[model samples]
Target: MQFSIATPTAAEFAALYLETGWGQWPLETFERALAGSWVVCVARDDDNRLVGLGRLIGDGALHAFVTEMIVSESARGAGIGAEIVRRLVGEAHRRGVRDVQLFAARGRAAFYERNGFARRPDDAPGMEWAGESRGTAVP
Candidate 1:
């Protein structure tokens, strides 16, 4: 497999996301998310098919958030996801970022923990607010 900083097509990203059992999102939504993201990494097989993808979004200064991490079902056990995370985090470090954050899906916390992420402190709880015009974009 090969990994590189990439801007993947909406179809490739949508296929990978579907592998996670998440509902299909529109191509435009995927494109819009990539347009606003700070960093992106994609893994391709020997055949040059996209098998993994992840992104980082933040101000690129003190804080960065890891998001949209997904590895195709056929490629999950090969450490592609971990490599993606490692590269993303390493890029954050290179940018002088101080905090890297992510909201891991249920049952996937162990993966992030193994990558050096810890649960939020007792004083800090994860929260969200969908605005009145909640967009369809993944966040």
Candidate 2:
């Protein structure tokens, strides 16, 4: 396995998504996601096929959020995912960004924890706004 800070093309991204049972995102969304990421790291097999991916989206100096972290099923147990997290975290730390965070997929918290992330406290759990919900509450 080899890793590089290269952004995969949309076709590569789509293929991996489908290959891993994650439905494909639209091309435009892929483009926007990649464009908005502060860093993207891709892992390739010996034959140079994209087998793992991870990226950070942040304001470059203060916050870096890890997302879209996936390793192809064939490569799942090879430590590629952990390495990807290390690289992403290394980049953020290098920039002196201390607010790194990620929403681990269900059943994936141990993986992130092993890579040095901690779960949010119950009272400070992450929240998401549903697109269909009315934003009626104001502070």
Candidate 3:
């Protein structure tokens, strides 16, 4: 396995989403998101196939949020995901950003915890609003 800071092409990134059951987000949205991220990292197998991906998206100075973190199911037990998080966090710290945050998938909090993320306290909850609840949900 090899890790690279290079950003994956939109197709490769969307494929990662599908492989991880994260749904196939449209390529155009992905292109825009990728353009906006401050840092992106991809892991490739010895064969040069994209096996894992993670990225950081946020304002450059004060806060950073991590999302779209995924490691191929086949690659999960090898610490690739942690490495990706470490690299992203390292970069964020180097840039003097302290308010890094991420939402872990169900049952994955421990993974994030081990990677130096802590749960936000009940007093400080994370909330979301989905555009006034149109009959359909996009996420």
TM-score to true structure, per model: 0.85, 0.86, 0.85
- Clashing residue pairs, backbone N/CA/C < 3 A, model 2: none
Q: Give the per-residue Cα lDDT of candidate 3 at 124.
A: 66
lDDT of each: 0.79, 0.79, 0.78
**Model 2 lDDT at residue 97:** 68
The residue ranges of model 2 lying beyond 4 angstroms of the native Cα positions read 126-139
lDDT of 1 at 43: 97
Model 1's alpha-carbon lDDT is 0.79
The residue ranges of model 3 lying beyond 4 angstroms of the native Cα positions read 126-139
Residue-level lDDT tens digits of model 3 in 45-80:
999989999998879877778876899999989999
Let me know the TM-score candidate 3 reaches against the reference structure: 0.85
lDDT score of model 3? Answer: 0.78
Scanning candidate 3 in windows of ten residues, the lowest lDDT window is: 127-136
lDDT of 2: 0.79
The Cα RMSD of model 2 versus the native structure comes to 8.7
Best by TM-score: 2
For every candidate, C-alpha RMSD to the true structure in Å: 8.8, 8.7, 9.8
